[model samples]
Target: MRDRFLTGLIGYPIAHSAAPAMHEAAAAALGVRVHYQLIEVEGAGRDDLRAMLEGIRRLGFAGVNVTFPYKEAVVELLDDLAPDARAIGAVNTIVSDGARLVGHNTDATGFARAIAPLLASAPRGPIALIGAGGVGKAIAFALAGLGVGELRIFDADAARVARLAGQLAGRHPVRGVASIEAALDGATGVVNATPVGMLPSRDSPVPDSLLHPSMWVADAVYTPLWTPLLSAAKAKGAKVLTGRDLAIYAAADAFELFTTMMPSTDVMANAFDAVMAARYSPPA
Candidate 1:
């Protein structure tokens, strides 16, 4: 009999991740005896990563999802990096083949597909993006691939944003701005790629007064599901795309990558919806 397959997500502070439930449901639907684990390697440095890889090999695990600070760090340790992942400078999915670990990025493609329907009929214009970190790089490239006319980038680390702007310059009209106010002015769409509205910080990246009804908003943080930036966008009458969409889409991509099977999206969506409902439901 074939060894039961195992896969999981690796990150620090992964207590709140939905990946375990998502993958477990997919595995059940496929009739596969797959186990999804969340390995928390808090402050896991180079040596910790080496041990984790060895452990995965020892257990004969199929693959793992890399998140947050590990995305970029794991790349250096991988045996191979997919072209798109190399371009984005991040990897969210990894597959281990014996001693070889391959890194790939499905986040950009997944996110692009999730938001495609929303942008189908809207007027294409410049998008102002706040943040130039790992996820930001993926989102920026995804927007370019989706055919955005221009991109205005702003980050607290001005140098990083400028570097990303330079990398994306030829792809589209790229402008690096120092002020958030300048970045948001007359922008067709706004993306909050920063962790500003994430768990610990419930404050909106931009004040509600600054948001316009015509703008479209996308947030990459899903913990709270409806982030302050998204809330402000909804209040301003903007079409809102929550981080949950990205999470679901990325999970679907990972499911396919790990299982090589297309699980029913409707089933997965229903499972995710139920989980979200239970999570946000009021106390009895």
Candidate 2:
């Protein structure tokens, strides 16, 4: 018997997401026929979102990936939340079982797995994280799991940063800083989870002079692969972790959740690299 085709991504402004490509490649490699689409729900009110969910249920989708603004919003619509998702107060992936909607958080696990090996060999020190939004919260929790001693969080929105700090206080020492420069001081690893260096403007969230050689920089923006934050980090001799790495790992996890089959990770990684390189390669 053939398994049902299923899974998709739900978010606004998903035109540049590499999720479809990565998931399609995994499905092809695993000999499963699956379909993953970008269901843009921007400007859609509550009723529209409800309708969309109903349509997905009717279509019998196994699951769907949520992103950005929708991560927190989708939680209210879910029937149950996975332990990790509940802890983080965010849901990046959702599994639909008949009429039950189960929410889960795979972003933190994926981020930690991708960067833990790199940090394992280095000396333990405090981490400086920029952007205190949904992705930032996930990364902060992941950092705690990775054994980070202290986290300095900075966000343009002071209230949001404070909220994130409060949430992480019991698990690890968290400090809410007023400026990015203050947060980066004596930091071992730096992370950018904001949209500053995403696509339209190639600008680093922090000044290059503030970055040191010993710091490790990770950006959460995958599109326009070499984000300004990463570029500056590379120039400063800081170990760089691209957002693409996170996407690859997260997509692999999502693939397993949606298909219940673990595809070749190496194949998926290689395919992701090839696709990204081709897309961003300089024109002749």
Candidate 3:
């Protein structure tokens, strides 16, 4: 096992991230010392990202986790990508060897691990997936790999939905629908992959009326753990899964990739929960 390592995360608006604490705790549990920094390159464009990546390599970073607004953008910047990252069209974790940087998509497996307990059996019913951006794409691939019968996708950008459906057509039954209602038509599960329900916003991507008691709901927004979507779904008697599990699972995988050592899920999860509770808890 590596005695020491340096890792970090790159993204815009990363002030809300609990990744540093989570990664440090995981490293400690693995008997390693990891200094995980928050590289907040807000409002950075493609060229800026290239410079940032080069800088990290020169600075001897083990690797960096790429987050929102940069997951897809980092794909072209990497020297190579793991098969899953290539297939998912997103890279959430990058590993730097002295020679070159390689990318991986832990989000797919992370989502699968997070949603495992929520699924009593492999579902064969269509799933309503909203949003087709980076995280949405990863979740789409994860659900497909989970043996979902069909994926009904809806995105504000029609072309985004078409591209995602086309990318996934060979592996699963996918449909690019015109509206959320159409996506939810025969779906037994609903996932909100959009940022509509994230921090500072009280809105839900799926309207309460559209949510039914029979459907199980999941949200990728962990900032507000009980997102409006999950709240509404719970109110309707629907089974619910939050993004916290996904975050912890993804962090564990990223930690492993960065350090070449497995991380303790329990330690990482506890660290994440503590950070979120401290930051988001009301002032006493």
Instruction: Give the TM-score of each candidate.
Output: 0.94, 0.95, 0.97
Which residue pairs in candidate 2 collide? Answer: none
Off by over 4 Å in 3: 121-123
User: Candidate 2 — which residues are off by over 4 angstroms?
Assistant: none
Residue-wise lDDT of candidate 2 within 172-202, one digit each (tens)? 8889999988998888889998888877768
Worst 10 residues of 1 by lDDT: 1-10
Residue 125 C-alpha lDDT in model 2: 83
Q: What digit string (tens of lDDT, one per residue) describes model 3 on residues 139-186?
A: 999988887768999999999999999999889999999999998986
What are the per-residue Cα lDDT tens digits for candidate 1 across 89-129? 88899887667777888788778987788788667887899
Ranking by lDDT: 3, 2, 1
- Candidates' RMSD to native: 1.7, 1.5, 1.2
Model 1 regions lying over 4 Å from their true place: 1-3
Evaluated against the true structure, the overall lDDT of model 2 is: 0.84
Q: Each model's number of backbone clashes?
A: 0, 0, 0
Identify the leading candidate in terms of lDDT.
3
Best-performing candidate as measured by TM-score: 3
